[model samples]
Target: MQVRNRQRLTLPGCSSSGGSSGGSSGGSSSSDNTLAAVGMTKNQFRCVFNPSTNRDVLGRANTAAMIDKHWTQFTSAASQLNFRFGNLDEAAVFFGMVRHEYGGYLDDMRENCARQGVACRQYDTCRQGGNNYYGRGPLQISHCYNYEAMSQYVGVNLRSNPNALLDANNNLGWRASIAFWTRPEFNCQGTWEAVRAFPTCPAAARAGNIAAVSQRINGKVECNQNPRPANQDNRVSWIQNVRTSCFGLPRLTSNLYC
Candidate 1:
C-alpha cells in the first residue's frame, strides 16, 4: 500500500514551496459558524492545518486552492449521500479523525500492508492485478471485503480497481471515506453507527468520547489498553486540538483515552 518514489503530478494551484507554521492557538467567535450543509470552509480548514506548516505524506505543502478543492469535493460527496453533520462539534470531530487518518493528503496510502493479513479468496480476483487492498483514501479503507463493499456503495469497481481511490481526477477518495463514515455496519471492533451516534448522545456520554469513536475505527489495536498507547493518545489529541485550538471550544475533560 505504500507509494513508491514517483514523481507526483503537479496539482492545479499547488506550488512546490515548503509548508507554513501551524495555525495560531486561540478560540474564535466564528468557530461555530460551520454549517453541515456546506461542510468545513477553506478558512476553517486553514485554522486546523496551516498550508505553510502542514505537509502531505508526499511532502507537498498544502495550499488554499488545494483546501478549497477538497472542501468542494467533500461537500459534493456528502450532498450526494444526503449526509449532514449534526453540529459544528460533529464536523470538528470528523476533521479530527481525518487529520489523524490521512494527514489531509488526498493521495495518502498506508505505509505498509505486510501485517494486513491475507486477502480473502472469494474476492481474490478483485485485487487489481498486483495491487493490494491496503489502506487508502481519507479513512484509510483497507482489505478486499471493504473495497468490495465500498464499490457497491459508490457504484464504482473499487474491488477490481483499488487504485480508483487514489484517482486524483475525481472525488472517489472522498466519496469512499464519507460512505465508510456513514455506514452503519461493523468494521473491526464496533459499528460506524456508534461514531455517527455522537451527536445525539447524552451530554455525559458525548463528553470526550472520541475514545468511543476510535473503538469503532481501530478498537482492536488501540482501545482497551490499561495504559493507552501513543497512537491512541495521538488520535484523541487530534480531536482535542481541533475542538479547542481550531474551533475555539472547551476541551473535553473526560474519557479522552480509549
Candidate 2:
C-alpha cells in the first residue's frame, strides 16, 4: 500500500462499498464536521457522516434480502450506484436533499432545491433536462423530470413516492453506480478509459473526448456538450471537481500539487 505524502486516498475506476465513509475538517469548529470511523484524524468536510464499522452496519450478508424486501426497486448493480451518490454526502445535506426532494414534500421541494442548486451552480438545485427536470441524483442530474420520464423504461414509478429515495436499497448506495455507466457524459466512448489520467489538462481533454462521444449520442452541440478549458469552472469541470473531492485526488492531468 503506497501512503501518499499528504495522506490522500485517490479513488480511480474500482469501487468499494463498506458501511460508509467518514470526513472531518481541520482547524475549524463545527459539530457536524467531526470524523468518526475512518481511523484517521483530518479536518475536512465529510460526505458521509460517522460511518458504522460494526460488521452488521454494511449488512452485506443480507443484500439479497434487502432486495427481496423491495427496499429498493433496483436489482442491478448499476441502479444501486445511481441511488448512492447524492445520499452518500453528509447527513445534513442528505436530509436537506432527500427530505425536500423525494420525501413528503417532494414535488415542490424538488423544484425548490433544483432551482436553487442548479442556478446557483450548487448541487441539489433545479436542473434543466431535455423535457423533464433531473435534479441532483447521481452525477447531480439536474432535471428530475427525467426520473418520471425514464420510469417507464425501468418500469418503476420513479417519480412517485418521493420518500422512496430514502429507502436503504435505494439510498444505501446505488446512485453512484448509475452515474458511472449511464450519464450521457459518462457513456461517451472511451470515456471510462481516460479516467486514470494524472493531471488536469489531460483529464479535461479526456473529459472532452467523452463529451465528443456524447455529441455523437446527442447529435447537437450544446454547452455541457464538451469539456471546459483547464481551470475553467463549467459543468464538466465541476463534475470532475466533485469526483476529485470524493476521491481525495486532483483530476488535473498535470498532477498540480495542491
Highest-scoring model, TM-score: 1
Off by over 4 Å in 1: 1-40, 107-130, 186-208
Residue-level lDDT tens digits of model 1 in 1-258: 111212222212211111111252323244324443744444455555556445554566555556556667777888887777655566667767666766444434333232223342222445446556666776777667778778866778876788788766577888887777666443422225534443322222234467666766766677778787767777777777667655555778776676
lDDT of each residue in 88-147, candidate 2, tens digit only: 222122222221122122112123234343332222222442233333332223324444
Q: Pick out the ten consecutive residues of candidate 2 with the lowest summed lDDT.
A: 1-10
Q: Each candidate's TM vs. the true structure?
A: 0.72, 0.32
Instruction: List RMSD in Å for every model shown.
Output: 8.1, 14.3
Cα lDDT, all candidates: 0.57, 0.28
In model 2, state the lDDT of residue 182.
40
Give the clashing pairs for model 1: 19-52, 20-52, 20-53
TM-score of 1: 0.72
Give per-candidate clash totals: 3, 44
Pick by lDDT: which candidate is best?
1
